[model samples]
Target: MPKLNIFVGTMYGGALDVAEQVKPLFEQAGFDVTIFEQPMLEDLIQHKTDVALFCVSTTGSGDFPGNFVPFVRAFHEQGPALSELRYGLIALGDSSYGETFCGAGRALDALLEDHGATRLGERLEIDAMETFMADDEAVPWVEQWIDSQQLKAA
Candidate 1:
């Protein structure tokens, strides 16, 4: 089975809830899914993950959630080339924040690309002001993402 790492960056647990809710979808598609509440850069590099899904909520002034700060810092400080990494992102934020909405996820998307990681599909940005449940949008997106990537259980 292809290994999938779901790295969650949540402020009030909304993002984590989305990750948990969507995990089984990937599992049913034959992926070995693991959700990391407090993700570390080493988790990505050490595991040789086949794919990664980042479910992050934007916090204070468009910043990363506290739990995800260290991982971002480590990636900035000692991250290596990730030309082989393929990933997806689900950004949860309230659009009321204006320009900073979904900032963390957008920034992470760029950071991953900067290191040569390939994003498999367009990033999903779930606006809290618009969606009552992040997982509602996330579930269908994951289903499409899986199909678009031509992924199947190995």
Candidate 2:
């Protein structure tokens, strides 16, 4: 089995909380999981991971979280390409952010995919101002994503 790399790029802790919620599932599935509280894409595997989940929260006006600025930039412009890797993303945000709710996740997912990474799952987005828990929204998506990856691997 291939190791799964989880990149938690967040500001208000929502993304980190999401990662914590999903940790058990990854462990049970026997994936060697590596986490980055603050990610630098160049430092994390690009083409090496079977699946890399980027959990992020959008900041002011659809901007990248402060901790993720460098990574978001490098992953889009200066980092090693992820063409050989399969990846997924989850975005956490307040719908009040309006025009660009979950913008960070959307951008990263698209940028990575554009550079040739195979996007393996339907990227999820959750609004903090909504009526449900963010982790809850991500759980099923993660499960479905994992299942698809398993099929691909087999």
> Which stretches of candidate 2 lie above 4 Å from their native place?
77-79, 151-154
Lowest lDDT 10-mer window, candidate 2?
41-50
Q: What tens digits encode model 2's per-residue C-alpha lDDT throughout 2-83?
A: 6788889788888888998886677677777777887787656543566788889899988889999988777657656566
RMSD of 2: 2.3
Alpha-carbon RMSD to native, per candidate: 0.8, 2.3
lDDT by residue (tens digit), candidate 1, 1-154: 7899999999999999999999999999999999999999998888867899999999988999999999999999996899999999999998999999999999999999999999998999999999999999999999999999887674
Model 2 scores a C-alpha lDDT of: 0.78
- Can you give the TM-score per candidate against the true fold? 0.98, 0.88
Return the top candidate by TM-score: 1
Predicted structure 1: clash tally: 0
Q: In model 1, which regions exceed 4 Å deviation?
A: none
Count of backbone clashes, every candidate in sequence: 0, 0
| The candidate that achieves the highest lDDT relative to the unseen native structure | 1
* lDDT of residue 122 for candidate 1: 97
